[model samples]
Target: MDKEKVEQLKIQMQQWLNEAEEFINHIPPVQLYTAVGVVLFTLILLLIIRLFKRTTSNTIILTGLSGSGKTYLFYQLRDGSAHQGTVTSMEPNEDSFILHSEKDKKGKLKLVHIVDVPGHSRLRPKLDEFLPQAAGVVFVVDSVEFLPNFRPASEYLYEILTKASVVKKKVPVLLLCNKVDKVTAHTAEFIRKQLEKEIDKLRTSRTAVSDADISNEYTLGVPGEPFAFSQCHNSIIIAEASGLTGEISQLEKFIRENVKP
Candidate 1:
């Protein structure tokens, strides 16, 4: 009877041990799965937050020679009209303007901060301060003055591109050949070709500047390529700002397609 009791006690102890071992074995996998699930959930949440942040933020900077319709574009963007030209100095305006379109019914397009910097040579310093923050640049060239003003326009563009390259390399630039309506003789393609020729000349000038051993000349480091050939490879939007012939729509489309905040 004593031996039988001892055997029964041993059997009960063994069963308890087995049960404990089973419990212990079950815990790690559950804990591991829980940990992995938590980690995955956290990562997914972070990714979603990052995506939302990126999609929400959008800023476009408009820069060009004075009288090229920078302010007109700004006003048109606000009131959807460009009856008269508007000019503003390179001052910060904290006005939030709505960009409405039938396509974006949800009003996802929020405050478009339009920075209208002075295009005069005197304002270059101020432009340097503001342009780096631009997600994209719209260069409005006067089509009527393309021949005479081409050099200055090209030089200004080069300067902007050089500065932006150092800071915002991926920013897209839309070279708008404005005042196309004034010149009924020249087609949009013709004007674009003329601009391309001027751009090529500028490229040659830039290359010369780079290759020249100007030990005597005041050096300001090797300037970046004024324009990325790849970016220019895209379509050049020609709009007659004098009369609104869907120019605003074209501008909006360009911004939507190229510039992501």
Candidate 2:
């Protein structure tokens, strides 16, 4: 009895298919072609969108002065341990992995592509190659030695904020004050204000130069007002961390915010 019922259902399905075919055949060729094209186009469009989403960059760039401890932070993020004796990196240290802190968390985590670009003036050009695809840029500063390196650090941050890719994409930046484990490390607020002041100075002098001589692709801050991180096109926030002590919660938070788990 079940076999007989199954045979009847099969026949009914065939009849419905035949009817659908007949109806389609009766339609004008132009209408039929148009309908088919629409479906194919929709399917192709959906496929392209899916591919684009999958390929969207999950890169987070770590950049600042040579002694700013970017390489140490990079290792800490990847290994969840401060790699002792880390020196100023001569080249970009890059890797792709699920963040070490997230390893014990339940469920799937996305791979983060971190590039610690060397901060030497000569190696600075390498920063541009990664900026275009950066999910977020972390400008690490040595808060312990903030006063001494303040000018150069601010200058580097200024260049980053004014980059064509950074401005156009409006990439979010985290001003990370590193080495806060030391008793004398400056506060994030202090570092932020000083950076703003120094960058304002840079803006004035650079704008005075002829456009031909200016290297920055975009101007930072409002013309009449003092330069602040808020004046830039991108969203900028300040956070503190200690790469040597492995206290990098803020840094990980910024990463997870930009590159979803």
TM-score per prediction, in order, is 0.63, 0.83
Model 2 spans with C-alpha error above 4 angstroms: 1-27, 30-36, 43-55
Please, what are the lDDT tens digits per residue for candidate 1 over residues 1-261?
699999999999999999999977778787968988999999999999997765443566667776666766765665666645454546532344665443346635446666666677777577666555555667777766666676787677656554524223455667776666674424546655565556656655655664344322222222464433334422334544442433566667666664432
Model 2 lowest lDDT segment of ten: 82-91
TM-score of 1: 0.63
lDDT of 2 by residue, 1-261 (tens): 699999999999999999999999899999999999999999999999998874467999999998899988999999988774287788889999999989998998999999999989999999999998898999999998889999999889988998888888789999999999999999999999999999999988887778876665798888899988888888998999999989999999999999988
How many residue-pair clashes does candidate 2 contain?
Answer: 0
Pairs in clash, predicted candidate 1 = none
- In model 2, what is the error at residue 96, expressed in angstroms? 0.4
TM-score of candidate 2 versus the correct structure, residues matched by position: 0.83
For model 2, the local distance difference test gives 0.91
Model 1 misplaced regions, further than 4 Å:
1-29, 92-94, 100-109, 125-135, 162-169, 183-187, 208-240, 243-247, 258-261
Superposed Cα deviation of residue 84, candidate 1 (Å): 7.7
